[model samples]
Target: MPVHRQPGPTAGATSQLWPSGGRHLWPSGESSEVQSHARGHLVYAANGVLAVHTERGTSIVPANRVAWTPAGFTHQHRAHGDTDMRIVFLAPSLARLVPDRPVVFLASGLVREVLLALTGPRSYDPAVPDYSRPARSRLLRVLVEELSEAPEQPLHLPEPQDDRLRAIARLLHETPADSSTLAELGKAVGAGSRTLSRLFHDELGMTFYEWRTQLRVHHALVLLAEGHDTTRTATACGWANPSSFIAAFTDIIGTTPGRYRSGRVVQDQIVVAQDQEQGSDRP
Candidate 1:
């Protein structure tokens, strides 16, 4: 079963207006209606996590990451946990600086600060000096430069094109906790394990386990947004123990479940430090 829920904002959601961007505080599970923008935009989840669903795929935007959607693509935003969501739209000229397709980028400390400032209270406060067009442009340019310098994260879960793969994907989406092996799942989808594995690599560019991890992470984020405890979420996502789940989640998300659930600023700096030590961002 696809995780279907009514689209649009739920009760208790509040937004702050800004010309170039805005800030939205959403309760857990709140989602925006499927919509398209005239200009490409970047979305960041400062406090919680966000899933940006587009026709191409879904991009997971945790505190350590930012998601960009190119102009004219239909997309929807869903909040995981109590989310402080920020949005910044780019002009046609600036939008050209980024990829035409939707992508997720690692959020450096500078990028996070710039996003907050662009959509912060200063934009709407009469007493505060607002970000002039040129100033905002500079900030946006900084964002583009920072993001462009690094490789895009593998946070996108691409939608498979094959019918057999789609069938198998649906099974996992409906019940992420299902511990079925590839051969077992292959039997239901009418494809041999070897054939399905080849299709996974050829179509989705990942192994079966890799794809399932992404799905489980997506589901886990939603569950956490609904106030599910880490242990419950871990078990629900097919992890036998919370320790294993935390290790996996932290490796991908750059933060532990405890900190993420508490809505604290993630230890993204730690990830940055590790990247710096490695001497390459592409690894």
Candidate 2:
């Protein structure tokens, strides 16, 4: 079920000016299986959001953020909207700059442009003059440099190492709208409320409330990316009302949910937002 758009060019195809793993476009709701690459790479969304899943956890990459997966790590990708996904591979030396664990980083305007230029279909437009290999190398380096200096976003919902934590995570993940209190959820999992709360903090480094808020906001992003209106998304994500959801979303995602739905995170304020997240579980 994996779709490889713009199939890798044959070997020796024009001395690829930069390290690119070809480009692919995925429609909303499509996903790839767990796969690993020989080299590390950056996965970027030109116009939508990507849910990058790995062993550690899932890192959501909206238009303003990029996801990094180190070499040989098993991973999968899911598209939230009509996503124009682009990739840039990295050699071992360059990959070392990025952590072995998956992470999401803010993508500035310059970084976005550099990514598009290197992977865009018309990158070699003769009218603009060919981008020589040397120029391409410099641009790629700049892309790496930008990522290295950018702050890491807490868009990751780390998976717990405990089976008890897994039970709680699975329940909420299966039904994000489920508003069961920690105590109520505990009943279903055979763990007491106090035990669950302690596990949540010890395993995930956040309180149960914080984790659920993160989970709800994550769903809101995916729904918004899918072009759903605020009211509907708010209802589906367990918000009492759109107003409350808007407040929480703006506080966490740094922009109103409506604006995100309109898809307007252009170069103007690409780096204006703080940490953001969006994704769901699938085996």
Candidate 3:
């Protein structure tokens, strides 16, 4: 079935059974309207990047990461590049094990395999005759266990509530490459660096520079997924040099940007091959 970017409270990001939770294949630039779920769910990007925006912050889910959206968090999603977006619904029993807030987790090799097998060709094979219900339940248990073992990555950019901090955020967000320091940015907002520091520390729990680096890395991910090269991506996201950008990206995203893009290209190729095979099999 063709997936259209949905609009409404749940929008198109609906919850489904464990075996095949709502999976969507979104084109580049597609976005869902603000929505909330009654059940917590896990979202995995089989081949692209997904950004989840909510009242508290924005969580970025790259191909290498899986995101947990706790139930009742009002959020919307957007896809950058052609995205193969997959989701898994979690009942309260399973959801209680993870963080209550939106979190991005590093998808280890085991986690990835379990996710694909649960939702891929193996799940629907006719040879299975009657797909073993107990086995499917076991796979789900393994998936949750593996995910719980992986560390929650710092892929979230916390949103500021203070009007002054928000003003500064807007400017930088509009131009992430802007090199202005906290003190310099304070000048525009008519506040001192110390005051802004207090706001960040009290509310967001991070220093100004740390917050900006996280923000820049978030932007860089979108750019890289959209096909930007290293040098250009570094420049575009406000890094003075590629080395510095690469270092920051690796520290936050767990991989070099080039490797990230290459991995995505490989995933795209696999999707194309699968599509061609599927078409040939059609009568």
Candidate 4:
């Protein structure tokens, strides 16, 4: 079932004074789908997962993580089903001071304050307050610095290579929870289990099982960001049980899947949500 909600008011009516902007808090179990207009914005995930998908690609924004979306890009925002999220949106003028591409930034104390201020109801005041100007300027500077200093070790999994491996990868990508064994996958791809294992390790830098587990984790992130509970996400991703899924998630992500999904983890929400509806019907 798709959970829908109304778009919150644009950030401080002062948004009109600038270009366009908004701030909203998506409680755990809440979601909203939006299509961008002439406005672009930078979104900061304060306490939960924020997932953004565009023609460029899909990105999972976790707590204390910020994402930049260029003007006119179509996208959607939602909280992980069991997790709540807080987000602040900024106009293009403010976003340009950040990065040109989508990036996750470490939230400094000042940055967090600025985000909170933007979401605050008082931000709507149009009066040019001397005190507010300096705060705004400092916020912009912080965004630029953080963008330039983004970490190199991003939490993203690369796609696999090799035509045969790619085919198997696609299958796994589509159905992360598919409990097919190496022999089964190899048979589907017209290769032996050993050959498939060797190919996965060579091209993806992981064993077949490892790569599949990574993919499953990635896909689980998507469902979580879409507001699906851990139980549903685990089942959707093919984990035999929620406990097993949580164990694997913690081992690989350094945190529980629920925390990662809700942006409580102290890292980027590296788990990516897959294209849903396409594979949910799969046996």
Model 4 TM-score on a 0 to 1 scale = 0.57
In candidate 4, how many Å is residue 71 off? 3.6
TM-scores of the candidates are: 0.87, 0.84, 0.83, 0.57
Model 3, runs deviating above 4 Å: 1-20, 121-131, 264-283
Clashes of each: 1, 0, 0, 8
lDDT of 3 by residue, 113-154 (tens): 777776654444444443367886787888888777778888
Regions of candidate 4 where Cα sits further than 4 Å from its true position = 1-20, 26-34, 37-40, 82-99, 106-110, 125-131, 152-174, 179-215, 219-248, 251-254, 257-283
Better of 1 and 3 by lDDT: 1
Residue 142 lDDT (model 1): 95
Candidate 1 structure quality by residue, lDDT tens digits, 76-193: 9988788899999888888888999999988887788898888776775666777766887788899888888756887899989999999988889889999899999999989899
- Residue 233 in model 3: shift from native, Å? 0.8
Question: What lDDT would each prediction earn against the true structure?
Answer: 0.84, 0.77, 0.79, 0.60
lDDT of 2 at 79: 81
| Decreasing TM-score order of the candidates | 1, 2, 3, 4
Which pairs of residues collide in model 3?
A: none
Error of 2 at 273 (Å): 8.5
lDDT rank order: 1, 3, 2, 4
Q: Please say which candidate is ahead in lDDT: 2 or 3.
A: 3
